[model samples]
Target: MPSYLEFFAGGGMVRAGLGGRWKCQFANDFDPLKVQVYADNWGEKEILEDDIHKVEAEDLGRRADLAWASFPCQDLSTAGNGLGLGQANGGDRTRSGTFWAFIDLMKELKATGRLPRIVVLENVVGLLTINGGEEFKAVVAALDRLGMRAGAVVVDARHFVPQSRQRVFIIAVSKTAKIADALVRDEPHPTWHPDPLVRAVHKLSGKCREQWMWLNLGAAPELKKTLNKIVKSNPVGVDWHPPAETKRLVGMMSDENRKKLAEAKSSGKRVVGTLSLRMRPSNGRTIQRTEVCFRGLAGCLRTPKGGGSRPRVIVVKGASVRTRLLAPAEAAALMGLKSKYRLPDVYEHAFKVIGDGVAVPVVSFLRGKLLTPLLRSIKKSRAADDSKARRVARGSSERKRRGQLELRV
Candidate 1:
């Protein structure tokens, strides 16, 4: 079975997407809460609940077929501090700076001849433009230095789920691995290669550009589910806002959003939409306003660190409109997780684990379309080489036996 090492494995969502086909050789994360959640779902046999920097290459045991890192994005996300990914050689000490530690680990693995055949890095789409796109180049360059060919695609969770979370997946393959021609393209696909990513690729240094790959993920699948389908009407762990509070929520809506609410109420049918509070300038003073989206999709789930960033569910049926915090289970469903997936009991802790994870279906799509096929090709190639070597050795042995018989005669 193919094996992988999952870094920054929040709640083991990647393992959930990888399914039982792949063996998880090692998993690491620094947050105690996230580690506990991951252990609850995936067990603690392979999990190391410690900081990435503290992990040594030897602790990873045998080399894995793939290494997946969904590193901290706080420094690289647009909503974050924009500190970038520090230095390529492990200089910075910020949250996102942990990326350098991952790189350093890969370098150590390579030195010890334990480097994985493939490496996948997942993070916010803002990674493509952070620090004027220099950081993206540095990442590709780092892979290049490891003698790997690197390519990336921007995958939005909306394609596979009801959430509008867009993340960039950087897939790097060892230069020695066998890759099928069908898995690459001369140009980028419009869906996966947005303008920012295209620009970032074009900006790579000449040497690194030579190793760049335009991965062909093929066509995106149609979204079969919507926000309404994923959201539970009578969600548990959260209560609906009282009449006065609900009125206040509606009153905070801007004129445009209020019109949307009015339209929903007039439809005479139930409407489910997501609400978020944004600070908008009014009369030269910034005031908080509630914005609602009725496009059958939820706004991207985010860590509920503060009140303004928390997402709310708005249900409008005829003249009555109700609002409430989005349930934890609903958040998990939005990330393509099954209902049976275990989550933390505390609401904020559960939201943090779910929000700070890769969409399960997106990872599954990449696994089926790219990673699995690539690994199969590599295995096939190695098997063929082994068979040829065995035949050669047999021939040599037979000749030696015949020579001995002649000498005896």
Candidate 2:
């Protein structure tokens, strides 16, 4: 079996997508809670729980066929309050410096000559434009220096799941490899030729485009599932806001949203879900403003911090309207975790783990459409080369045998 090494392997969501093709030989993460959830699900799977820098690359024993690093993206994410990568105004760089640690690990592996055949990195799309696109150029150029040519695509999770999460995936292969990606943009596949991905590629510097390959997974199927279908709506509810609290929430809505709420009530549609609440200025004072929607797709899951995460989701079916915290199972399903996936008991922990994970079907799509096929092609080419070598060796032996017979005559 082809083996893989995964970094920041939180919750093993990537593993879920890779399916039965790739065996996860080694995994590492720094978060204890995420490791706890991974252990609960994987059950005694060998995991290194120390910081990446502290772990010795030689300790891995065997080199992997593939190496993946999702890397930490909080520093690169736009959702955070700090400057992206927490860099001083074009001077002091802090949080995003964690990415350099991943670089160190890559270098260490190279020094040991155990670096994997294929390298894949995942991070927020912000990396594409952060620091005037300098960060992204550095990433691709770094791969080039390591003797790998890089290809990139920015994909949204909503296509594979019911959540609108967008992330960028960077794929690299050795420059000396004979089999390479098609690197063409005009393939007939549907989801493979996405607009954002095109934009991402176009934005690369001339040098970045030199080794670029277009990874087209083709048109993904139309998602038949909706947010309402996956939801494990609680019958035995928890954290249901009292009527007065509900009234306050309703009152805080913008006039436009309030009109929609009223329309829902008039239409006798009993289901309601509030997306989020934030402070807004109203008549010389700041008050909370709320937003609600009955849309099919859900807002992207956010990491838990204060009350910033898991806003109220209200369900109204008939005479009764119910409001409560979104169930953890529902959150897990949005991440494409079907079964054999375990959730932490605490709501905050559950949200944190799921929020940080890539959607399973999206990863699975890449495996079936892109990674597996590429690996197969490489194997086939290598086998053909070996056969040619054997034929040449046999021909030389025949010539030697004929010369010996002639000498005897």
Candidate 3:
């Protein structure tokens, strides 16, 4: 029943997950490539392919019933652009700026008495730690300035997808109506102390590391996934293996570094400490092995770099496995996108799209568990207001009738 505008609408993942039930009024993204991919699947609605900073809420014609934003996570992601939240990194200029743009739009709506009832925002888990936590406080402060109360939760894609992508979701609701006290608990907010292992993972954004830490990876690592299950078993008839030189170089790391790598590989542990590799400095290759601590879940899929040297699943000989990369479709599934949802691009591009998306099930779960309940409360409060107005009108008319009767007497 809610009408919405999805901002930073990459791959339309948010729309796909929420569109089945909600009425989408508008959506937009800056990337033309992503726009093309979105059109191929969703059939081209009112999607604005412009910088959100340049687009005002009023430009969209009307305020929607709900506003959704899955803004750029590059500034907050350790694995991403790593542009810490600040003015210099275009943190306040690019996608990070989109958050303010959305807020500005909300403010514009408030000016016109048309603010949406609900707002849901999603981002990389690193938002909780970016800029040493000041960036996070700034975000919350912005919401507070708008007279909204927000709640956040870190959701894992593995809950729905085959992969272990995790994201932080912030749901904000205007505090004008009196909501049930039970619905708003006074729980202590989470503090910001960067997890050391997570810091390492961010340095290696190939996978979502925070999730690995939460699982007590030492005790329970990600379950191993065979390349065959993740990729088309016979992709282009190419048996992906490191070149002999690359293999030899990896095997020649410093003795100490080599020992740590071997130990981590054998125990299926995520290597938190950095290691030195034995490759040409220009090649920028590492002998690092994929942390298989928790094989039950797959690491977050990244957009395959067109470069053939992009990382691959390795099947160490005599160790019972073959290594290769997963096709984009499989990566999409890891992001909790339905298998049938077709990507309009080749494998690598599709992987990029999927990697830069919200896990479908994570959003769906939040919609059901958090957003829906807040919406229902808003509905009930509106009904109560309407009912109270009717009673007041009736009471005034009855009082007038009694006055007339007294006059007649």
Per-model TM-score, in order, reads: 0.94, 0.88, 0.74
- TM-score of model number 1: 0.94
C-alpha RMSD of each candidate structure in angstroms:
2.2, 3.3, 8.1
Give the C-alpha miss distance for residue 101 in model 2, angstroms.
2.6
RMSD in angstroms between candidate 3 and the native structure over all alpha carbons: 8.1
lDDT of 2: 0.73
Ranking by lDDT: 1, 2, 3
Report the lDDT tens digits of candidate 3 across residue range 1-409: 7778888888888877775788778888889888887887777876878887678766666767778888878777876575644542244555565677778777888888777788777878777776665566666666666777665656656656556577776666675654654454343222211253234324432222211112100111233433235545455424555466435544555555455446646765332221122234325764443232224346665555554434344433322334455555656656656677878556566666876788776677667655666678877998999999999999999999999999999
Candidate topping lDDT:
1
Q: Give the TM-score of candidate 2.
A: 0.88
When 1 and 3 are scored with lDDT, the better candidate is 1
* Model 3 ranges off by over 4 Å: 59-62, 79-94, 180-232, 235-239, 242-294, 303-311, 315-320
lDDT per residue as tens, model 1, 276-327: 8888999999998889989999988888889767789899899988999999
Instruction: Answer with 1 or 3, whichever has the higher TM-score.
Output: 1
